[model samples]
Target: MAWSHYREMIVWQKAMDLTDEVYHLARSLPKEELYALSDQMRRAAVSIPSNIAEGYGRQTDREFRQFLSVARGSVFEVETQLEICIRQNYLSVPDAKTALALCDEVGRMLTTLSRH
Candidate 1:
């Protein structure tokens, strides 16, 4: 199957899972953070899949690859924010660990796709 059709794509599936986890995590943040970290995390989470879907729908390998690059950047952005969250004591060690691992997986997937 093509890169666009990796049904068992751990990255895509993990991205989806990460989005859900972010939503759940955001719920625990202080209400004042609603427009801050919570909002940023949600947007970053959404960007991952949005980029993938937009790229896949572009109907050209170059366009798809370009969007994948965007998605990869978002993954890094999220990872960095996650570290900040840890430093701020906003997220527990386990939560940060899991989120970072998922982001790493997405990064690896994007890199593999780029090489194709």
Candidate 2:
């Protein structure tokens, strides 16, 4: 289907949701992590949707696919960071379920999009 805007895409919308959740999660981290793990998580989370929007705006199909790949990688990065937080006792598993689910969803969507 042809989408007029990136916002109209379900994947993009989900990614934005993921970003929001990650930001909230980051806020729960210790003050020492404000410039460390927290910032890294925020940046990776933000990259997912940002890359999607940027790719959607690109002129060429290859460029769009490239950006989607970047976004996909960011999804994995965020997932790893989430795991790190969990292991570090910064966040509990129950508190991270939603964001992790979103990460999985976004990663799958990006993979599907990049294939076409």
Candidate 3:
């Protein structure tokens, strides 16, 4: 499929799912975290799919790679935040594990896309 068509691909769909998971996870945080950890998590989560969609719209391989890089960075950011949450007792270990796994998968996908 063309890149535009692939823009609607299932992996991208999965990434969106992961993003939603992150959003929900962050929303469950205590009110005290609303503008701090919660907000940062939400933005980091949203950045993954947003970068992918934005890059796909650019229609250039290099640009797509650049945005994917941004997306990958966001994944790392989310993972770090999740770790902090777990350490601070904001998130359960299991929840943090799941979120980290999702971030890892997305990171792998972004790397694969960059190399291709």
In terms of lDDT, the best-performing candidate is 2
Worst 10-residue lDDT window for candidate 2 reads: 1-10
lDDT of 2 at 109: 92
- What is candidate 1's lDDT per residue for 1-110, written digit by digit as tens? 36546445666778888788778877877788899998998899889988887777786889988988998999998888788788888888797777788888889988
What shift in Å separates residue 95 of candidate 2 from its native position after superposition?
0.5
- List ranges where model 2 is wrong by over 4 Å: none
What does each candidate score in C-alpha RMSD?
A: 1.8, 0.8, 1.5
CA lDDT for candidate 2: 0.96
CA lDDT of each prediction against the hidden true structure: 0.82, 0.96, 0.84
Q: Which residue segments of model 1 deviate by more than 4 Å?
A: 1-8
> For model 3, where is the 10-residue window of minimal lDDT?
1-10
Model 2: clashing residue pairs? Answer: none
Best model number under TM-score:
2
How many backbone clashes are present in model 1? Answer: 0
lDDT of 1: 0.82
lDDT of 1 at 46: 88
User: TM-score for model 1?
Assistant: 0.89
Residue 22, candidate 2: alpha-carbon lDDT: 98
lDDT of 2 by residue, 15-71 (tens): 999999999999999999999999999999999999999999999999999999999
